[model samples]
Target chain A: MTLASPLAALGRPVLAALAALGRVAIYAGQTFGALFSKPFYTREFLSSLLHVGWLSLPVVGLTAIFTGGALALQIYAGGQRFSAEAVVPQIVAIGMVRELGPVLVGLMIAARVTSSIAAEIATMKVTEQIDALVTLSTNPLKYLTLPRVLAGTLTVPLLVAVGDIIGIMGGFLVATGQLGFNKATYIQNTLDFLEGADVVSSLVKGAVFGFIATLIGCYHGMASGRGAMGVGGATKTAVAAASVLILAANFLLTSVMFGS
Target chain B: MIELANVTKSFGSNHVLRGVNLIVPKGQSMVVIGGSGTGKSVLLKCVLGLVRPDQGLITLDGQDVAKAEREAFLARFGMLFQGGALFDSLKVWENVAFRLLRGPLKRPKAEARAIAIEKLRRVGLVPETADLFPAELSGGMQKRVGLARAIAAEPEIIFFDEPTTGLDPIMAGVINDLIREIVSEMGATAITITHDMTSVRAIADRVAMLHGGVIRWTGPVKEMDVTSDPYVQQFIHGRATGPIAAVR
Candidate 1:
């Protein structure tokens, strides 16, 4: 078969990209409009809380414990090169409270919750359940998206707080047991080094990340194309979008909180 | 009453509903029949305001339904979806009493559950079935539960999208009879979209055939068998040699 010229070869990709971008724009508009609409799904919202909040605690807690332990060891090792080993306690405390805990939990939620939400909603849309909702005098967005979004916004900050404490505790365990640091001294140093600003910043990051994760999931799921293939594509897109947006927002939040 | 005038819906280059116009009188059952991908579901969705038509007017009782108050218009109707569409998280009673337990019609849970059980019983379901989830029900039972939910609020209009698509012949017949009985007893205008001719015979007072994104033939079900419309004849007969092409 003869190959197409370079100009012709570029056309398909360009058109595909534009089409994708157009779909994203439409999804954003639909979600934004739905956000303000009335007859919100209160039952769906409460149910989403059970899904996004209560169901997520164990994983978030486990992740925090391991991450905090690893982080303490890494900080101690790096601090030793400059004879700054004693700084490990302070660094681990500040880092867990201000940065790693919320960011990691946000990323985890983006991976787990965002993908599930996207897949579930996309499947419903593909199967015409969304249409069924409309015909039943229900607004799909109000009945679907708002609840998920609200649950994320409310629960994620609480998750971040739990994760932060667990992470710090992990660091404490590692510092005292494995690193041979004095337990009381390590705890005292951690408490002395951390401030309200660090905790507040982490919680703020949690809220922002939660919003991003749910928004991406809702956006991709609502704009999902037809059939199983469409739902799979939506799940992939939602996870990717949530992950990228979480990281970017983490960076922006960190800078705004600490750069000053 | 519902009327669609010159309604058109297109997806990019694919025109799904092409200037389709039809009318359903008040408190009557109308079945729209067509093969898959022929825009039968799309037409129902347009009338339900799920899909916005590119051009035309949809009116209910002389009021412009397409531009009507969304909530007010939607509250007037109920829909039984193709796959039942019950929420998996809710028990059978919760699903049936969905409207009664929430929003504008919020009732006490006990009261709603009682009504739900009553409605479930009306659909030939046992009271014990109310405690089960949608996932626990068989396909036929799930359809019955959906029918119960549709009639729970005694809607003025009801839309049934493929109400018998996945059921056995016996179950399908049961559902068709239930739909017919419910619509007539409640004096509700009913619109059903299906490819099943048996369903059309059992549930529809009038039959409209959709082909190539438009209404090909629309008249009383009594007239459908005798109509000279090639599309309807080929469709109802399941023939491959007429204007309709066989699936490759």
Candidate 2:
């Protein structure tokens, strides 16, 4: 039955998007359930941790350092107009811990880990390795999705914490060298300005972004269509979805944690 | 024994399985042959509980497989996929012993590796091949590794999906002979889905022809040549024009 209504033109794609969202939510729920279930694949978990966490450090660290340095320079220029140059240390600390650190780490993960995970698992599905896992009496969700999700959720926070430190240090280096701030005074102000809640919020944002990135990767991989184009499309969609969701999640988390 | 009664499955506008009914008896090799997209693989998956049928019943040894305890039910079956589908991340031995190293079939690490090596040898691969990854092997070698993985647990029921697809004639012949010998030696019930007549002749104790989602014919292999059904006749003789309607 064809509808004469103009809304019909927009109906199918919107419905498909909603349906895809529904499937991802269900998949996420099942993965969470699998987390507590038996036959937990420790071997898969550790290997995934190594891949999604340890291997991702260099990219996240490099992104953070550069971003922090750039942020300090921009803030310094803007501060000059208002004669607020004395606020560099405090501003840099707050910026790194509260916003740039988690967001940058999350986006880096979306670029590095999400695409790789999606490509690897989508290839596995294409080759029937996933079906083979089923025949071998192994739950693919338990063996594949849960470990990657757990590793991402647990490790990205730590990555964010490390990134926060490195980013703040980058700002300090730039401020002390180019901006002529006193090293001792900058360090003291940075330490004095950062509260425990700031650290907590950064770690919490990291954890949430990590979950979003990894879960989207696994979801796209599992729900991929058939053949090479299917896998390629899935890999692309995973990164895009992870990036967008990381930003959206960051906004939601920020509002809840700091808006009040 | 496995049975599918009035099973039906469809994907949107496509009707893949339509009221299909068939029975595979114990301790015998049953091969189902059909053109591409005839739902042979879907039927196989339905029995394995990989794809749930939209309607009808599938039973293994008279018990519904869908309702059986998943781990115990799957432990009884092994399947060799169309492609080798070996885990590229792991060594060949690790792929072979994947089942043995985890879940209900868990074995000690050394024991699993040893058994994997033994199974590899049984499929004509040397112990040296065990350390290489699947990507390092030729297509034929990867298929042999898949065969090794299939039999690693010595499952009571084995399903081979297009076992000889994508192989040269010589390699296909070798795989067919190996399958016949191994299945006979293991005394396991086997179901192989393939359009390769050579494989059917070499492996099937019984033949079932599937077309339009139902069994068009079923009988002993000796009578496959004599089957009067037009679909069976066309498929066996490789005819483009028949009741099977290739383009439609």
The residue-by-residue lDDT of candidate 1 on A157-248, one tens digit each, is: 99999999999999989989999999989989999998988899989999988878887898789878888899999999899978988998
Per-residue alpha-carbon lDDT of candidate 2 for residues B105-216, written as tens digits (9 for 90 to 100): 8999999999999999999999999999999999999999999999999999999999999999999998999899999999999999999999999999999988988888
Query: Per-residue CA lDDT of candidate 2, range A1-260, in tens?
Result: 46656577688779988998898899999999998889888888999899989999998889888888888898899999999988988998899999999999999999999999999899999889999999999888998899999999999999999999999989989999999999999999999999999999999999999999999999999888889999999999999999999999999999999999
List iRMS (one decimal) for every candidate. Answer: 1.6, 0.7
Cα lDDT of model 2 overall? 0.93
Model 1: pairs clashing at backbone N, Cα or C within 3 Å: none
Best by lDDT: 2
lDDT (10s digit) by residue, model 1, range B79-189: 898889887767999989988876677789999999999999989999999999988999999999999999998899999999999899999999999999999999999
Residue B87 C-alpha lDDT in model 2: 95
TM-score of each: 0.93, 0.98
Compute fnat per model.
0.53, 1.00
Error of 2 at A71 (Å): 0.7
- Backbone collisions counted per model: 0, 0
Model 2: residue A251 alpha-carbon error in angstroms: 0.8
